[model samples]
Target: MLAVAAGCGGGGTGADHSTMNRRDGSASPGAAGHNDADVMFAQMMIPHHRQAIAMTDLVLSRASSERVRSIATQIAGAQNPEIRTMSGWLRSWGEKVPAAGAKAGGMDMADGMMSDADLAKLKAARGERFDALFARMMIAHHDGAIAMARDEQSDGRDPDAKRLAGQIVRSQTAEVRTLRGIAGGR
Candidate 1:
């Protein structure tokens, strides 16, 4: 069983329109209110989601199990839109949007992201080995995301950002359970 490290951060599903309007009576994405936590959440989650997408893509071509493929597909479906949503929020906030292909390393890997070497091993796996590896890795990945989302819920100031954090918590928590089952609770 691969042990996932803890970390301290999802989606456009939650839009708190009540807080979206500025005092000037104009609408803005993150203009309603945000703090450094919100900024950090967006910055960190983008690459995390990208790596998850990459992991799912790797399984798509190699895994023979229907369950694994389905889970991978669902992950990509949910996260691809989320990546765009976070990117948009960063743009609205005048923050630097991380490049899509950028690999997380060193301090950036604090989010429980798989290292490049881990990804390489996952990419090199095949058949049942691939499915088991994918399950273990994704479970850890989802746990890290859940931790970050919980933090965002507690510390973030933006309504939209907090809402998205809650969504990630709920959705990814469930996904983690599913992945755990696939991994035989490893």
Candidate 2:
């Protein structure tokens, strides 16, 4: 018992993304009795989702491939709702939501976020260049989200946040395969 308690003392374990119930059997209202990990997950993922939507918007205007454009539309359709959901979580948690125009916030590289200059370059490229770059960048972007999601799954305290983390990992993993297919054709 002493050894178990010692091991679980720190948040570094990244386990326990399971059904968490307090002795009182009531989780914190909207925050699901969240810890710092939950808060960080919501805050970070909000901007990451925003950037993905922006990239999809670019794909709509520039990409000539019907499949690519269609996938972009699908991505925006999926992520916009998710963005709203995360925002709600943040508000419910009494945490400040990142601005819509906020940059990647932090962990930009780890989060697979594109820089302003990278976005500008993507915007300027035309035809195949656009399609290929779009797929490549988005794959990288999705990969970052997956990584963050996995972290949340291991470390987050909120049940909703951890569940969403698992979902993100699954969906984005599939999307990465699709993106790879799209990039392969080029």
Candidate 3:
């Protein structure tokens, strides 16, 4: 019976202690419940959504077509609240809420974000030219957001975070199709 007791005790020798405690040796209540993917999704998406809001603001000022203006308004309405929601999640998780003006160069380029030059060009464009550029750029931007949301759905652990990710995927996927139609001059 002693031999059996010792064998069972040995099973914990190589156990992962990180799961029980944080790196700083503090007992983490929430750390064990959430994963890296959940943290990353909020971090990256906050800035992505901020940029989308910025793009929409620019288009709303110069777009000649009412349809373009309406779309831009809708984009801003949806994303501004989402930005706040994700920021709240990061705060609750004890993670850094990325600064509003922070550059997102470290994020995946294939995630469909625009470059500085692209924004500058959009800023310079007006009327019909502005509408076309806005449509094209926003289409790509929404595609990137959809990709990140999909990753969160697959890899995230927190229920609230996963639910928000699923929502982003569905809404942004529809927006992509609409933006594409506008870009194609429909």
What digit string (tens of lDDT, one per residue) describes model 2 on residues 44-102?
77778888888888876788899798888878877776776666666765678889788
Per-residue lDDT for 151 in model 1? Answer: 80
In terms of lDDT, model 2 sits at 0.71
Which ranking of candidates, highest TM-score first?
2, 1, 3
Clashes of each: 2, 0, 0
Q: How does model 3 score by TM-score?
A: 0.81
After superposing candidate 2, which stretches have Cα over 4 Å from the reference? 1-32
TM-scores for candidates 1 onward, in order: 0.82, 0.83, 0.81
TM-score of 1: 0.82
Per-residue lDDT tens digits for candidate 1, residues 73-185, read 98888888777676666676667888868754332445668887888999999998888899999988888888888888887766666777888888788888888888883
Which regions of candidate 1 deviate over 4 angstroms? 1-32, 105-110
